[model samples]
Each structure stands twice: as C-alpha cells, then as structure tokens.
Target: MKKEVNIILAGSLGIILGIGLFGLRKFLKKKSQDYDDYYADFHRHFVKQAKDDGNDGIEFLAVQ
Candidate 1:
C-alpha cells in the first residue's frame, strides 16, 4: 500500500541520518583529543627550552 511505502521510506531515512550523526560525533571527538595531546606536548617542549636557556617563560604580553 502507498501508506506502508511512505512509512518504510521515512523509517529508513531516519536511520541513515542517525548513523551519519553518530559517525560525525565520533570523528570530532577523536580529532579534539589529538589536538589536546599536540598542545600539551608543544607546551612541555617550550617550557623545557625556556628553562634550559635560563628564562622563566614569557611574562610580557604581545601588543596587538
């Protein structure tokens, strides 16, 4: 019946959309974690370098 076909099509569309959204969320979460890790490593390296060179890190703010 026509009504049954419409219901089936709507159901399938909803399921596809849900799956797409879930996949996007997972991908973003992973990318965010990667970015955080990179920032931490960079900060550590910068601090170590500053200390080795006898500096206490940058306290002066840059003028915009």
Candidate 2:
C-alpha cells in the first residue's frame, strides 16, 4: 500500500512540474515575441525618421 501511494505521489509531482514547465515556456515565448515586435517597430520608426531627415549620404550612429 505504501509503495502504491508513493508511486501515485511521484506521478502527481511529475505532472505538476511538467505543467509548470509548459506554462513557463509559453510565457517566455510570448514575451520574446513581444520584444521582437517592439524592436521591429522601433527599427522601422528610426529608419523612417532618418529618411525624413534628408541626410541621404550620411550614416547615423545608434546610441545604446
């Protein structure tokens, strides 16, 4: 009886850990995508602003 209870507890713990890992992976993926989208948007805006500045032959430095 004790062995069966231990097995069941172990299985339950494994399932819980698996679910937590799955949720973390999904959250990280969504956050990464959001960061990528924000970067793309900023890049586009920077390029557009540079183009509008009318300095066609000059390169701009990106300040971090």
Candidate 3:
C-alpha cells in the first residue's frame, strides 16, 4: 500500500511538471513572435521615413 501511494504521488508530480514546461514554452514562443513583428514594423517605418526625407539612412549612424 505504501509503495502504491508513492507511485501515485510521483506520477502526479511528473504530470504537473510537464504541463508547466509546456505552458512556459508556448508563452516564450508567443513573446518571441511578438518581438519579431515589432522589429519588422520598426524597420519598415524607419526606411520609409528615410526615403521620404531624401537622406541616406547612414547619416544617422554618425557619432554626435
């Protein structure tokens, strides 16, 4: 009886840990995708602004 109880407890613990890991992976992947989308939008705007202003984007890189 005692061995059976231990096995049950271990199994439950393993299941909980697995679920937590899976959730964490999903959350990180979503956050990573959000970051990539933000960067792409920023790049698009930066290039558009540079083109509209008639300046090569490299001038912004000069040390002040």
Candidate 4:
C-alpha cells in the first residue's frame, strides 16, 4: 500500500511539472516573437523618417 501511494504521488508530480514547463516554453516563445516584431517596426519607422528629413538617423534602444 505504501509503495503504491508513493508511485501515485511521483506520477502526479511529474505530470504537473511537465505541464508547467510546457506553458513556460510557450510564453517565452511568444515574448521573443513580440520583441522581434517591435524592433522591426521601430527600424522601419526610423528609416522612413530619416529618408523624409534628409538626415542620417542614429539608432536608439527600442521602446514599447
């Protein structure tokens, strides 16, 4: 009986940890994609303005 209980507990813990890790990976991937998009948009806007104003533009840190 004790061994059975231990097996059940271990299985449950493993399943829970697996689910948590999966969720964390998905969240990080989404955040990385969002950051990439933000930077691309920033560069596009920056280049457009520089062209319009006829001045070489300097790159600054991207903001949200």
Q: Which candidate comes out best when scored by lDDT?
A: 3
Candidate 4 has its poorest 10 consecutive residues by lDDT at 55-64
| lDDT agreement with native, every candidate | 0.83, 0.83, 0.86, 0.83
Model 2 Cα lDDT, one tens digit per residue, 1-64: 9999999999999999999999999999999999998888657744633245555443454432
User: Considering TM-score, which of the candidate structures 2 and 4 is the better prediction for this target?
Assistant: 2
TM-score of each: 0.63, 0.64, 0.63, 0.62
The per-residue C-alpha lDDT of model 2 at residue 26 equals 100
Evaluation by lDDT, superior candidate among 2 and 3: 3
Q: List the residue pairs that clash in candidate 2.
A: none
Per-residue lDDT over 1-64 for candidate 1, one digit per residue giving the tens place of the 0 to 100 score: 9999999999999999999999999999999999998887767744634236554456633432
Q: Which residue runs of candidate 3 sit more than 4 Å off their true CA positions?
A: 43-64
Q: What is the Cα root-mean-square deviation between model 4 and the actual structure? A: 11.6
lDDT, residue 58, model 1: 62
User: Tens-digit lDDT track for model 4 on 1-64?
Assistant: 9999999999999999999999999999999999998887767744634245554355533331
| Model 1, residue 24: C-alpha shift (Å) | 0.4
